[model samples]
Target: MDHLADSQRVLTIGEGDGRFVAELVRRFPHIEVDCLEGSSAMIARARARLPSAAKVNFYHVDALNWEYPVEIYDAVVTCFFLDCFSDKTLREWLPRSINCSKPAGKWMVAEFREGVGGMERLRSRFWLRVMYLFFNWTTGLEAKQLPNWQGLLDELGYGCFEKSETSNAMIYSSVWQRWENARKTDGFNP
Candidate 1:
């Protein structure tokens, strides 16, 4: 959360069970957070997890259809959330989602990724397939494979400045900032 220490407003999409939100508020009590979650059950769990005094607004809505406020947030966070959608959905949804943040905003993402090489790649592929199959069967998730999220973010004019991988490179966390030129050319107005 060091990256968000100075942020006044933050948005988190599909933040399950409020663990991250609770920790976020605990670390930065001054920040106001808006959490968009599709599941009411998850939202209830999240609300129960947080102290009543927390500066959190829980929106029980799907990110794809939610009308995002214009340039209102300092950062956007998605943890294991974007992987639930198909590539086509992401291409259309991500730009709109990121638009809610200011021109100099940060986007923090933690999600599953295919491994780099060798046995790591093979192991990642195996686990990913299993995960997709399980989630598809249980949750009716539309994504059968992980998309090139990094490439898509690049196209959206964001550049990754910090990144790390764990779980044998099957999972990654990264921080991204909008390119200076993108601020002027991306066409979103504050």
Candidate 2:
């Protein structure tokens, strides 16, 4: 969130209960936000969390069906959200997500990652399996394993500018930026 302190327009996908959104609004009162979530209940909860004066547009729509337009946002965020979809779904959604950002826009992501090896890998896998089972039953999430979002981000012209990990690499939060020298289109000036 600190990386985006200067952003004037942000888009958050699956903003969940809106805790981050609320905090972002408080931290950067000048920014406008487009908050997208699939569940109306979650949307309502998120909206309630925001300050009454914050400028946020909440959209209750599936990310897959969102009409992503080019050069629309200064930053895009997804926290514990992309992991819900299968790799194929991510392949389809990621490009759309990046397409919404202006050239060199920031993309922030927070999600669990499969551990590298040893006991940590075993423990991480166990917890992830449990999560998959629970969310599959309770929320109908489709993915059984984490997708290679980093690779896709690279393929789509994003470069990791900052990254942090926890739980022995079982989880990670990263901020990637679309290349500053990326071709400009339709008056995009990043």
Best by lDDT: 1
Report, for every candidate in turn, its global Cα lDDT versus the true structure.
0.88, 0.85
lDDT of 1 by residue, 1-190 (tens): 8889999999999989999999999989999999999999999999998877899999999789999999989999999988998899998988777789898888999999887889988998999999999999999998999977778898988877777788577789988888773355343232
Q: Quote each prediction's TM-score.
A: 0.93, 0.90
94 Cα displacement, candidate 1 (Å):
1.5
State the lDDT at 133 in candidate 2: 94
- For model 2, where is the 10-residue window of minimal lDDT? 181-190
TM-score of 1: 0.93
Clashes of each: 0, 0
Would you give me the overall lDDT of model 1? 0.88
* Candidate 2 Cα misplacement greater than 4 A, ranges: 180-190
